[model samples]
Target chain A: MKEQDDKQIIIHVDNLVKKFGDFEANKDLCFDVYKGEIFGFLGANGAGKTTAIKILSGLSSPTSGIVEVAGFDVYKNADDIKRNIGYMSQKFSLYEDLTVKENIRFYGGIYGMRAKLIKERTHELLSRLEMTDYADKLIAEIPLGWKQKLAFSVAVLHRPKIVFLDEPTGGVDPITRRQFWDLIYEAVEDGITVFVTTHYMDEAEYCHRVSIMVDGRIAALDTPDGLKQQYGAGSMNDVFLKLARA
Target chain B: MNRFFAFVKKEFLHIFRDYRTMIILFGMPIAQLLIFGFVISNEIRDAHIAILDHSKDEHTQKITEKLVSSGYFILSDELKNENEIDACFRAGNAKLALVFEPGFGRLLEKTGKANLQIIADASDPNSAEMLSNYTQAIISAYIKDLNMAGYGNKIIRAETRMQFNPGLKGVFMFVPGTMALILMLISAMMTSITIAREKETGTMEVLLISPLRPIQIILGKVAPYLLLSFINAIVILALGFFVFGLPIRGSLILLLAESMLFILMALSLGILISTVAKSQQVAMFISMFALLLPTMLLSGFIFPIENMPVILQYLSAIMPPRWFIVIIKNIMLKGTGFLFVWKETLILTLMAIAFVVVSVKKFKLRLE
Candidate 1:
């Protein structure tokens, strides 16, 4: 993994709370993601990880909190934050009926990228993924692994400052998951911050820092080694169990 | 503008590449037009009938001849008695039976009133109702002719004149109504489904996370549908004019302008539906039950609104297509100008604005 010692904070959240009626989906959340660092948002099912990500990405609003993304207020400057961030959802986000090139071009164009730049990036992305032959192929014809990778590439086509990946490797093989992480490492190398959510502990260990949510609050927030040492556990899975059990 | 076009192009790809959507968007209107124009018409011609005459007198014979010669009915058989009436109907040889009462001519001469029983097969109530109506009209005309023969004074003659549609062609009624239905389905249902599909596949989140404004996203999604539905309206009008000889008696430009207005209204309705639906299936169900069925049933498309119960008539007044069909009929059939249809146009404009405002508000709420 590339070193992320710049210490420039990109995302700042303080005491964020989101409630639906009487039920709180996220409660008293506080975290910060640094410049060019891979911040893993780890949680079990219904752990409010998705809810926190939504608030940070400007997809939803918090009931009460101070949340800043890419140096802009989530409440007042959501559009500016949107322009500076990329999002790849857990569900496949590409138009399955559209060709791979069309999908990339559409995302690039919507981000106000010039036509010439979109063409250049299209060439570079397809070549980087070794998918030059599959540019004209419909997304539905591609394998799930390549599709997720392509989705990630499309998400970052405009080179946003930060990218949010919500469970980008949910149902992929081990090799593909590793390859997806390699892409994240490459993006981080380019000084693009990554805020990703996952339940995979092996993937959690790859992050510079991790925050594990239990119920609707962040139960633990630290580096993987720090968390494991603090809990006297061998792996992130056990650390999560020890924290969650407590 | 470039981003908007790019988004719209993506939408077009989603539409044209999917054969199911293509069939529904293009093929359904033509099929509905052909079916409604030729097969499911209300103009009765050569309907089968059985006659049971207890009085073989001149008056009863004259009435039967008048009914058959009016070209609305053909005598399939002559029944012997009341028992044969049910047999004739059960055999499906006739949809209607005319029974002349005993001493019908004598009763008419003495009391100036005669009795005849017309029994219609009521299984399919709409057709049965039409059959009974046509039979009554024919019998009434015969009675009028009999009075004109100087046997008695003619009582209260009504010189009814049917303007525009002198032949009362069923095509005239269906063309306007079908246009309303087709435009609403293509604009509202298709746009809603496309948007809901994006939501289903999670591309909607990607969209919301983009720099494009929510209004831009919505307009981008519906712009292609607007163009295609406009083309569909023109095609339906051309077919109605050329194939069925339906007329555009008013200004063609005004007709098109009104159609565009209705399409806008329907697209706004689509946006509203998409706001409430989270999945493609749910969107489709809501569109079908909420928009499509109401546009068809309560829009005065096939049924006469004035003849419906007063409560339903009041309900139909709020149906957007009801006003749209009336405006289209006035422009295409009645040859009326803007003065006659301005109220309908204003109503449709208000509805379009209302839908757009509601959907935009709901969409902003969704984003928050």
Candidate 2:
């Protein structure tokens, strides 16, 4: 929404390269995510989207790159970077046996939040998500939509500077995915930057900016409308197809 | 520290909520102790035997009465002839048959010689050998009594004494072995599976991405198991003491300290396994095959290490439970102090350190 020069950059990646043994999972990737914006990372399976997200999240070390998150270097200040970010994967990260309230409390406690703050925030979160009635219910008792939303909420419970979502809405219905994006918009409104990776083309349109990776390289990156206009396509899907064909 | 406690608390919740884990943590130690103590024992009690006494004299009746009343044998049947001895054993009604061949008390008084044959089933060779040894010991005692009464010139006699455990109670050996086995199972297997569960469910990624360090996560995962395993060890020791009459002849503190050390070693080994295992099933498999089987077979828990083949003996030298069993036996049965068991303790200590070092080295800080 704002000019790139005026906005603050929360994540900065320059010539990031990652290799595993003789295979390169990511190659010469370059990108930046501004604070308080939804950045979509789009790629088909094995395009190395997850690998790049892992490196940016401090979950994996880049073989060679200048990657920074929340102004912390990926190589040296990984722990600091970890403290400033949150993560959720497609595999429903909530402890199934733990109640919703307990999961929230546990995540908050591990993030070193004060007991009083965690308690207050848990109450606020349960009500805000309209899950106050389900606070004492185990995560297994909740529906898939609620579980995804709860996972996203827990990821941002510490008010992290950036939350990484690795296919957070993989199997959810379109209606629920729309609701999940609403939550993401709410998080951005609260000044939390979101970096999400997905294969859903329609989800790409909702992002303030998007990067399409192909064969371990970023082939295209721009705002959804800007990419459509540049590629002379009607939708992000056609733009992706054009790039793939190229 | 607060975060660590929170993580440990969550681990405890996981263990307590899972009934299977609850059964394993509490039920296994007691069940194993009772099974090893009451069942699967070497000591015999109330063994049935058939007596064929041709003499029908006072000495023969007295010896039969002595064997029955010694609490080792029961007079199950009176055989009519030598032919019935075979039938009694074939029917599985008797484990041994005692035959006295046309022995008159007058023969012993005049010539100082009597013929008595003790036929054992020998199908169960160990028990058969034991029954024969017991019968021989009682007969020899009777002969010695006769000599003491000046019935004849002195006769040659062999005496054997069982030291430490004079009763030869099988529980003595099993108590230490079971303690080692249960501690290893709970500490190593449970911890590994729990860690693998995190990886399988993808919670590990979230935890890794959090402010918690990898060391903190590992310690948090292991802390509750350590406490639970220590409690399990105490329960086994208590059962051994009160139920089986196994003595803590040495310093209980030293014994418990050694147990704690063994527990540390098992916990570290568990962490190492988790580092390699990608799923809960793989972790469980590795724990069962790599830990449980070896502890049962190679640690001299059920089999003697000395009786093993040359290579297995060498292999057992690296088994942590083997050294632990030795240390426990030395303290519990031999009543030895730290000075006597320092070598075994040092070995266990070194193993614990090595496992911990290797685990930390193998534990991935990044999700490679």
User: Which run of 10 residues does model 1 chain B get worst, by summed lDDT?
Assistant: B153-162
Can you give the lDDT of residue B341 in candidate 2?
87
The pairs that clash in candidate 2 are none
**How high is each candidate's TM-score?**
0.90, 0.98
In terms of TM-score, which candidate is strongest?
2
Q: What is the lDDT, from 0 to 100, of the residue B148 in candidate 1?
A: 83
Q: What lDDT score is found at residue B326 in candidate 1? A: 93
- Sort candidate 1 into its docking category: medium
Query: Which tens-of-lDDT digit does each residue in B1-368 have in candidate 2?
Result: 88987898899889898999999999988998899899988898999999998898888988899899899999999998999999999999999999987865667777888788999999999999999999998888888888988897644666778899998899998889889998998899998999999999999988888888889999999999999998988899999999999999999999989999999999999998899999999999999999889999999998999999999999999999999999999999999999998999999999989988888877774455
Q: Which regions in candidate 1 have their CA more than 4 angstroms from the true location?
A: A1-6, B51-70, B78-86, B96-160
Between which residue pairs do clashes occur in model 1? none
